[model samples]
Target: MTETSKNLIAEYYALHLGELRAFVAKCTGSPADSEDMVQTIFLRLLQTDKMISAVTLPCLVYSAARNIVADYWRHRKSVERHETYVKSHCDCGTDSGPASVYAPAEIMQLLERGMARLSPKSRRIYTMSVVGGMRVSEISDTLGVAYKSVENRLGAARKEMRRYMSRMLA
Candidate 1:
């Protein structure tokens, strides 16, 4: 940037730092989060050339700060939601615990071998429904097959997995 642009941004920083920090604190409800968000806001502003536009400086700074605050809250909310979900779903031996417990590696190996034994169509449908976590309707749409065909494939895969598990254990 030219010296003129550099001087203009420096002026913006000097004039707005306290107001920005205060605004962030009000929006975020925590001093530390506000401080971090304000830093990010200023950093983003400095990295861009928008500071050179005389008419857009105030709007740009405000918009950037708002976006930063919004993103922080959005991310914070998602993390909190995920934590609650994990806590609610966690089963350490409770009645609501997981129905079956298989290590990921074991499950992967079992799935691989079981799928290998299935017919190609059955394997595709089963993988889409179970491993890929696709809905029956989604699989039907993706494979251009009827829902009944998908259901049959899923049943066959489940039966095959059961037999495969029995053989492995035996």
Candidate 2:
């Protein structure tokens, strides 16, 4: 980078750092993330040879920061949608209304019967995850078992429970 360009960027950074941070923080709702984004914008500006010289520096930086914030929101929304879908499918009790085929009480009975049918290890893992509210990794660590083993046990338990519930509902 040329000395003049470097100096111009430094000047811009000095002049607009606070404004950019405030604007980005407002957009992203996170002061820390906004600070990182502001640094990233300046870094991008420092790397490009001609773009900084071609456009108004403040305008370019603000525009890039806005784009970053927009992308953050878009990515957050996609993750939230995915998490909602996964929770709805993976958890049986997430839905229990008039449209539900089985009443909550019947579902609880089925769950209890199904849990009773699980092997000892599987039952413990399932209870720890679903009832004790422990994460799979935490259960694995607590049980001194491999992470994959805990996951497999949980998966098998869920499948068996689903089958039992389906049969009872039918």
Candidate 3:
């Protein structure tokens, strides 16, 4: 685009920034998402090679903001649906709600079996975090392991335990 077109866009963006932000917020009903959408709108404008006419810039900005809000809601719904599907199919007893299905006796028996199956390092890391109430950083410092290693082992341990519990319960 020409310098003149750039100047026009800059001026228009500067003059109407708040209106654009408010427009997105009203469209999405979320100030946080609106802020992101506003940035995306201007970033698209600034990066594009096509020259936008001064008269048409406002319409294009509003139209793009509307499209972004629609896309955000669509993506949000898709994610929620995916989560719902996973929750319905899997009874891993990872959280308190579904985990209540197992009686205390069954939970104890399953937990012991699960812990026994994990690698020694993973089992120790899991214990340090869960039983010892230690954070990942503290565990890493005490064990002289990388922070990520401690974190990863904790995740692996949990996954292993969950799989074992699920299999036993099934």
Best candidate (score: TM-score): 3
Q: Which ten residues in a row have the lowest lDDT in candidate 2?
A: 86-95
lDDT of each: 0.77, 0.83, 0.83
TM-score of each: 0.52, 0.52, 0.53
| Tens digits of lDDT, candidate 1, 1-170 | 56776677678889988898999889988878887777777676677765466676778778988888887788789779966864564454565445444466876887688789899888888888776867787899899999888887898788888779667644
Judged by lDDT against the true structure, how good is candidate 3? 0.83
How large an RMSD does model 2 have? Answer: 12.0
Model 2, position 55: C-alpha lDDT score:
58
Better of 1 and 3 by lDDT: 3
Write model 3 residue lDDT over 1-170, tens digit each, in one string: 77887788889888998999998888778998888789888887877787689888888888888888987888789779966865576665565574546677876887877898888899899989877967798899899999998999999898887678667866
Q: After superposition, which runs of candidate 1 have C-alpha atoms over 4 Å from their true positions?
A: 92-170
Model 2 agreement with the true structure over 137-165: per-residue lDDT tens digits: 88998999999999999999989987886
